[model samples]
Target: MKYCLSFLLVSLFTSCKYFDVEKTTSEAILKEELKTFNWNDVDTYPSFSICDSLISKSEKKECFQNNLSSHILKFLQDEVIVVTQDIHDTINLQFKVSEKGDLTLLEAKVDSLTVKEIPNIYELINNSLNTLPTIYAAIKHDQYVKTEFELPMVIKVE
Candidate 1:
């Protein structure tokens, strides 16, 4: 009886480590970071146009109108230029939400940006992704659903 009790105690202790382990992907990390901002609490949610037909038709017009706004358009253009110029000569970044509620960055391609620039762009993208309150609000408001989005942009030299 003593031997069985000891074995049970040992097994319990061994399994404790596994319970503490948080298995997460990069996307999840992003989502958690975004949650830190409590974007849902903000008023005047940011808006965007829906290019994806999969989104509900009722929200499509609002999404498109939001996309045409000067603020968002400038932000998108600036982000594309900064990322491509600082990270790679050719930049392609894919953003998606993981099932665990984190942002996942995939298909990152930089043909010519320096090694240092690559990390900078990654940091920039991560920062931008995390702080997007408007986008998060839009999703929560049912203007958009959680899904993979592909946006291709170019950086024009001055």
Candidate 2:
């Protein structure tokens, strides 16, 4: 009787289902995330000239735009995985670049994305931007150079 009782107790305990650890919401993931930039050691491109005398302000702005686009594209290519069929659709990201060229990630709104999804979407963009290599450029004497930049992104569900 004792042996049977012990076996029964052991089996009961062993067969019981343990509560699962709750999965974190996308917001939580976004809030606490830190992305790292991984530039290819051998194939890294040279930094562009920031102080070219011949380059006009418009040209310098174009350079900045191109640099930012390339950085974002490389990130999406390497780290992101698109899960949706309509992943090719573009999402406009409205943000500001400080005089120091630091990005302040702001509100992200899309027709396809629900209000709840906005936080996650913004987080993803922020992570991608954080991982991009820095562009060290001397902005010509324009006090508080705040520029708005829009970049197209293809979202992956994964």
Clashes of each: 9, 2
Candidate 1 off by > 4 Å: 1-90, 98-102, 114-119, 134-146
Q: Each prediction's TM-score against the native?
A: 0.36, 0.49
lDDT of 1 by residue, 44-115 (tens): 222332445435544663563344333323554576443344332445667664433355567656554443
Error of 2 at 124 (Å): 2.3
For model 2, what is the error of residue 9's alpha carbon versus the real structure, in angstroms, after optimal superposition?
99
Per-residue lDDT tens digits of candidate 2, residues 1-158? 99999999998898776645678999878666624322212111222444244245556556666776666656656654534343435566676666565776676655564324343555556777887565443332333344555655454443
Best by lDDT: 2
Clashing pairs in model 1?
27-102, 27-103, 27-104, 28-102, 31-103, 48-63, 49-63, 49-64, 88-113
Whole-structure CA lDDT of model 1? 0.50
Best by TM-score: 2
